[model samples]
Target: MKKTDVDVVVLGTGNAALCAAIAAKEQGASVCMLERAPKSKRGGNSYFTDGAIRCAYGRFQDLRAVLPDLDEEQIQQISMPDYGEEAFMADLLRLTDGQTDQKLANQLVSRSFDTIQWMMKQGVQFTVNENQYYEKDGKRQFWGGLPLKTKNKGVGLVQALFQRAEALGIDIKYDAKTTALKQEDQLKKLIVEIAGEPVEITANAVIFACGGFEANANMRKTHLGNEWEKAVVRGTAFNTGEGLTLALKAGAVRYGQWDGCHAHTTDYHAPKTGDFNKPGDIYKKSSYPLGLIVNVKGERFVDEGADFRNYTYAKYGKETLKQPEQKAFQLFDAQVSPNLRKEYHLPEATCYKADSVEELAEKMDVCPESLANTIRAYNQAVQPGPYNPAIKDGKCTKGVCPPKSNWALTFEKAPFYAFPVTCGITFTFGGIHVSPESEILGDDKRPIAGLFAAGEMVGGLFYHNYPGGSGLMAGAVFGRLAGEQAATFCNRTKPLSSKS
Candidate 1:
């Protein structure tokens, strides 16, 4: 049996948790961070992230002098076009159906730049680039997304944050799981858990920075649906949604539960054989456009040939629920093979070559006769169809764009490749309810005593869709807010009488 005490107890050693600990310690609070996974890998999901905390608004006006490549106008475009207090509020309302806590959402987005600069002051590396046509004004900006390329200094920005957290003397505990809530007088108190034996830690605040549930199959099935449960766990392996479940069990409300893990096309089976091939993540250029995406009944759904700004795999997930199996196909002709094989090696790309469409359909596991007939009709389309008369229209699941727009290959060009694609989830958008000051809000809409929450556990923080890399950005921003707010809360108010 062992016991420890601190002003704040943070769960997880990931970026969110680490950032919270770093911020808390800097704010003159004794901080301790816990990790449920192995410390060697730095808690999977966050460690492998593309590592750029996407922050919009306010360009680095002075940096342009040294880096001539990035200009002021180009930087502005990279940020979300609809940025403001109103945009933040509206986004939460639209996505959460007016259930989001508007105050907290505004706080997180407003303080994003401060969090970024704080990380920089702590010796974190970053790159400044002008994202031409990325958003409004094309203003020059910093590399909030590309952390690995910073002056060739580090592998990831979050990785550098981890190093900085360690240097700041924040207690980093690995393989520690917070199992129960230590409630005093019906108010949330310190986190209680057992590592190897009996252990308890006393703290004025506990932050659930542990990631959302995208890895645990049962949790995924329960939340997303039975079929989607089998989806390949794409986020961090350590993110099994412990905070989500634990908070709910403790009467915590939820937000952004509907916002799911989204992805586009990535061929797992076919990889390039060159020395320059690199593993991809949220940043890599997708190997789409080279394939014709089709729905279950051997039908073209979207326009299939358009720019995919936010085209995600979640679109397909919605369709898979209505179809026989969670499935979709990318059809490509010989002309596309070189671009895919030579340029971007698609994983698990299946090649089907036959004299007739029916034979190719048979090899692809699609409706052999139905697919053949559909192809024949499509080839003869006079009025032009996603233009076939047969087969039910495709289930254009995730994208807001036309499906067939990105899908080409008329099947008139024989010898095709059909790669099966899936809609896998990554991180969950739902989280613990809070106010901007990192104060946890109860059902009564008041602060939950001295308790607080931020990071992935932030409920009602996001309005509608995520604004690019705002997840990590918000984590750093709000985590800092929580630490400082909690510190101020403790400073202004006298210590409680042995409650927690």
Candidate 2:
């Protein structure tokens, strides 16, 4: 019903979209952002995350540049290892099993720390992650790779970006869903739904950063195979693939793994869609690395300790989906019970406790006989070694199928706990193909003029899995690039003003 024009229009309001808008505005382009969610739930997948962004750092000083609040005591308390761009690249390629695009991976790693510093200039604040690391014998140690996160978690991350964008005069429209896109020569048009009514927006250039199609059950069942509809959506319900779909309709090339996604071990009782009230990844159950996980048949399906939790957690949910009835349970003994993440303690969490393995299985409705045999075999196979949670201790099972390759310990301690778990789809890896400059390419493998993409919507950076904390990093890196490029494109081609 209403028509408006801007120099640049950014789709979505998460980290990627916000970064794109900020960069475009800095380039002297009048920017407007379109968000599908309501004002109260504006942030997309970025709001549901822990706000961890993997960055390449050469020393403590490099970290201090972004996290200025690191006191001498806090610095002395932790072991800060130098994580270079080479290490970051290796991690990306290794986690994705060499399926990540080399160019995209290079850009993500090289720009990671610098992007965080740039975000700091834009009022985004970060701190060393306490959740991913631990303190032992007065020496704090980092685990699951290099770590940095927003000071107030996901909420703070988005709020900081929002503050910067607002300060820069970016117009953001919430409850505006982009339904269709049309090209009128040099100008790009977007038809959006606002309060159940259609409104047309025209822009010189567009940056698509809305995210993937993880929330669409139909898309999931189609691309991700059968029973994927049962996977719990771990982020915004609004990211149902319109961005990727409309872009493809307008000649964007589809790339990356059509069946691949990033998932997490979420509580089995989590809602079908992400709970807006529980905004900060509270539904995730990350304690499986310190324990054993089994299906309803009481059998370990995958190696729980194949790698650090950061690398393995993203793919474990898929293995969970393949289990019987798409359900599994994590069992932890009293010795390692206190080491679980903060989410396990939430009042809404579904957990059962018992003094024995059979009792625990009974409470969780698992086969008691099979669970007892599995536990007995696991305990018998655990070879003794120095148990270090900060690194791969190689305390492993000697003769078990799908052995616990690290942090292996007997489950003989009393007061055992079991938590039911299911797959929580974070974001799909199938997305639009883009050039090194973040320009979305068409099926002919050429960049489409006046169009760019960032975040999860621009795939080829991941495949079957991804390393934890890297999602936000990739989002920031490509978001900045796409924004800068879109701004340049818009300036090169002047479109008619809406006021005309």
Candidate 3:
């Protein structure tokens, strides 16, 4: 490959990268996207996800859909901003231990929605109302709606962004991976090693969209700690956090490390060898309070469905160690599989099943007698106001969430099932420090000239807890900011103050 130049050189080709490239091009700045992976493999694991972002506007809408009974108090419980920027800043403080620059977080949060509308104009789709308005809190609200309307929502939206990015004449290169960020005279450049040669491109702005390091297990063990490595399999190999590495090498500020985690899940469908996840892998469905989680000892442990967060393994303040198997079988009934709850995206696909408790135990690899007693005892909770202390005291109690129907499953019928499952991490919370203007920052909170950040790559800008579809919302948000801001910067370039 030959050398090239553009106003912005974007690494990675996922939602954030595509969003940034589109943003820069729309703002009239030349932008080029380089993907180390081939086009067919180019659909990074992000495509498999439902890009949840927690923008103030989006949360209000999603809450209407998922939690119809929600109110101000519930909103306070779920959103990051409830307590103040201090609570919202908690993750950043823990990640950098109060060493972070707050200016960047301020910038990303402020510009989020403007970013969303910009993408909407670019033809990226989203969900909309059935008629003229959506029902919310017993009232009607009307927003333009998401560009994509399928049940598989964000997937289509991302596809639309990809299409628009190509249509806009943005340059996208496959198999052009950047190895590092090289700085000269205090300026940043991408170092690409292609076909046994090093190609350097100095740019007005370098946007780090390369994803989190979930796939890179060794690296995960190093920075994120060994517990993460043992907890979940990587969802996207493309998201190796290479951009994060480059940003770190170039002295970019880091924030929200503690905020990021291997999104704890009932399954990422790791294969038997523990090698990279294969394409055919399917997620086993697990429902809250409906199933009892058992450890190897045939004893119930932590909550299987709650936000296990890393706290599940605090070891009373010691370094959190990996839990064995990281596997917990979800025991749901004939009804759970047929109609999984409303909030989940995919259909409920389950694992082993049997008519009798003895047979179900055989499939789950637990003692049939003990397993039978566990289910029988749990079923007894249905008749009363409170659950049996023994059953509630089990590790399974940890994962329980309200609206969770533990009593709904009586384990009473024939053909019960056990879905052997593992963990799935969606995104890491830590990312390049950026401003509300989407400007990438240096070690000291100053803008690194000619560089910007956006999407998941920019951290600590979020409100406290995740809002549904907020990740996608934020990606659109920051991508627009980066593009618009970089355009303004590029536009401001003037004829050298001619000192003739």
- Compare the candidates by TM-score and give the number of the best one: 2
Give the deviation of candidate 1 from the true structure as CA RMSD.
Answer: 7.4
Question: What TM-score, over all chains together, does every model reach?
Answer: 0.72, 0.98, 0.72
List, residue by residue over 152-219, the lDDT tens digit for candidate 1.
Answer: 22236556777787788888777777777765642334444445554767666667778777677787
Question: Mind giving the per-residue lDDT tens digits that candidate 3 earns over 223-270?
Answer: 666665655543456677777878877778777664355353444254
- In candidate 3, position 54 carries an lDDT of 32
CA lDDT for candidate 2: 0.89
The per-residue C-alpha lDDT of model 3 at residue 191 equals 76
Candidate 1 lowest-lDDT run of ten = 271-280
Cα RMSD to the true fold for all candidates: 7.4, 1.4, 8.0
lDDT of 2 at 20: 93
Which regions of candidate 1 deviate over 4 angstroms? 58-101, 127-155, 185-195, 249-251, 256-291, 302-307, 311-314, 317-323, 332-363, 367-417, 461-467, 493-500
State how far residue 225 of model 3 sits from its true place (Å). Answer: 2.8
TM-score of 3: 0.72
Worst 10 residues of 3 by lDDT: 311-320
